[model samples]
Every structure is written in C-alpha cells, then in structure tokens.
Target: MTDQPQGAPVRLTAFVHGQVQGVGFRWWTRARALELGLRGSATNLPGGRVQVVAEGPRAACEALLALLRGPGTPGSVTLVVEQFGAARGEAGFVER
Candidate 1:
C-alpha cells in the first residue's frame, strides 16, 4: 500500500519493449486505458518499442501498468520500463 491519497491523479509512462508495434498493441492499450477511465496516448517508437503514457488516479494508472506488464496483451512483451509522476491534466486516450 502507498501513502498517497486515494484518487490522487498520477502519470504513468511505460516503455514496452519487444513485439509491440504493428500488432494492435496500441489499440488494445487504448481500450484498457479507456476502460480504466484514463487519459493518455500509446505511441509507436523507433527500435521496436511502444510508449504508453497514461494519467488518472494512482490506482487506475497502476492497474494500467499491471495490464501492460501482464499476459494477454497484444504481441509479446519482453520488458516493461515504467516511470511515475504527477498527472498533467490531459484528456482522452489516443493511439499513435
């Protein structure tokens, strides 16, 4: 458990490596983020990686990160690099 207040907004930036691009991974991430009521974007980066930035309640962001690292996601994930911070007041989730 964390000491942060409940429902406090937070940002989750995750760099997912391995077979993530051209595999509907962004779409899947968008769906999951929307379902969690998060606002962010999933963008395909160079060197075969996907960058997922999500902002919302800390719990929601953590959930999204968990899903990103868990099984059943599109393509295969060999490594998940995560960073957290205060939310930036963004809206809507997009795939890029």
Candidate 2:
C-alpha cells in the first residue's frame, strides 16, 4: 500500500444546473458543507450554473455531491462533478 494518508480530504468542482441560481443552492450547499465539517465555497456561474468546491472526507464529499444532483421540481437539477487532486488550503465555505 501507499504511504499517503487514507482519509485525506479532496477538492472537487461540482457544476449544478437547472434552476440552481436564486434557488438557495449556494445557501443549501454552505449549510450542508458546514454540517459535514467540510470547507469550500459555492457560487453562481455565468450560464445558469452553480459551482461548488467542497473539501472534506470522501464520504461527506460524496454525500454533498448526491444532494446536488437529487430530483427536484419542474426544472430539476443536474450535477456534474470533476474531481480534482486535493484541496491546496482553502479557508472556509462561503458564497462567492
């Protein structure tokens, strides 16, 4: 096995679409990430997409991603995740 830590946190970019902006998406993610003891930020992109970067244990990160892609109202949300290497050193979670 490798010598690296097993539970080291990660950095991921999640693109949430469909009624994401102005729909409390950032708030929801911030709340959830905090509850999960994760750190990162969520923001609205130019083209109707909400982007989030969460850094924490793998399990919690996965849960956050699942919620981002869950079913919704008439205009349901779709989450596209792009896993990055890891969190360099983000301070905390916030809206940007």
Candidate 3:
C-alpha cells in the first residue's frame, strides 16, 4: 500500500519492456487507462518498449500499473519501470 492520501490525484509513468510494441499494446493500455478514468498516453519508444503515462486518483493509477504488469496484457511483459508524481491534469488517454 502507498502512503499517498486516498483519492489524491497523481501521475504514473511506466516504461514497459519486452514484446510490447506492434502488438496492440498501446490500444490495450488506452482501454485500461480509460476504464480507470486516467488521462495520459501509451507511446512506443525507440527500443521496443512502451511508455505508459497515466494521471488520475492515486488508487486508480496504481490499479492501472498493476494491470500493466499483470498477465492479462496484450503481450508478454518482462519488466515494468515506474515513476509516480503529482498529476498534470491531462485530458484523455490516447495511444501514441
């Protein structure tokens, strides 16, 4: 459990590694982020990684992080590097 205040808005940036690109990973991430009421983007990086940024309530963002690391994602995820901070008030989740 995190020490953050319940429902406090936050930003979660996750760099997902492994077979994540060209596999509908961004679209899947966008769906999950939308479902979690987060606003950000899932973008492909140069090194075959997916960078997922989500801003929303702390708990919601954490849930999205968990989903990103879990087995139900579109492709095999070998690693997930995460960073959390204050929310930036983004509008909607997008697949970039």
Candidate 4:
C-alpha cells in the first residue's frame, strides 16, 4: 500500500494508442493487473489500441497505470490515455 491514504477503491480505464493491438498488450495488461492484486479486463479495440479497465485499491490501480505508461509498457505502446473513477467492484483481472 502507498504511504498516503487513498480514501476508496477506484477503477482505471486506459486506452493505449499506437502499435498496441497485436503485440500482446492485452495479456500483458491482464498479467500485471492480476499481479498487482487488481481486478479488471484488458480488451483490444477496433483501432490500433488496447483498452485496460482495472479496479482495485486506489494505490494499486495507480500502480497499474504507471506500469502501463512506464517501463512495463510493451515496445509497441506509444501513448496511453488514462481515466480514473469509482470502482465497479470487479472480481478478477482477465484478458478479452
């Protein structure tokens, strides 16, 4: 857990643009989300983008965001669009 007190759990939606669809971006996102103890799904959109929806403790979700946007990101992921909000209380993380 992070040092700061994150008031409540949250859900994070990220649209990773660029060459993100065919390069295992969804699976990578799922694995990382599950590893972080978050629950959500990663799906490939019609465009060359991957959408990651993660729900968990605020800090964990934030960590997921950092991972996708930082070094943990796949080589194909050039840009990441992130949105945060209240959690939907999902159960497990998966790839779709």
| Residue lDDT tens for model 4, 1-96 | 333346777888889888877677788888888889999898878877788999888878888888887865665668888888777778888788
Better of 1 and 4 by lDDT: 1
Instruction: Quote the lDDT for 57 in model 3.
Output: 88
TM-score of each: 0.92, 0.83, 0.92, 0.86
lDDT digits (tens) for residues 18-49 of candidate 3: 99998899999999999988999999999999
Q: Return the top candidate by lDDT.
A: 1
Count of backbone collisions within predicted model 4: 0
Model 1, range 18-96, lDDT digits (tens) per residue?
A: 9999999999999999999999999999999999999988889889999998998999999999988878888899898
> What are the root-mean-square deviations of the candidates from the true structure over C-alphas?
1.9, 3.1, 1.8, 3.5
lDDT string, candidate 2, 10-47, tens digits: 77778777777777778888988899888989988999
Off by over 4 Å in 4: 1-6
CA lDDT for candidate 3 = 0.90
Clashing residue pairs in all predictions, respectively, total 0, 0, 0, 0
**Native-to-model Cα distance after best TM-score fit, residue 80 in candidate 4, in Å:** 1.0
Clashing pairs in 2: none
**Candidate with the larger TM-score of 3 and 4:** 3
lDDT of each: 0.91, 0.76, 0.90, 0.81
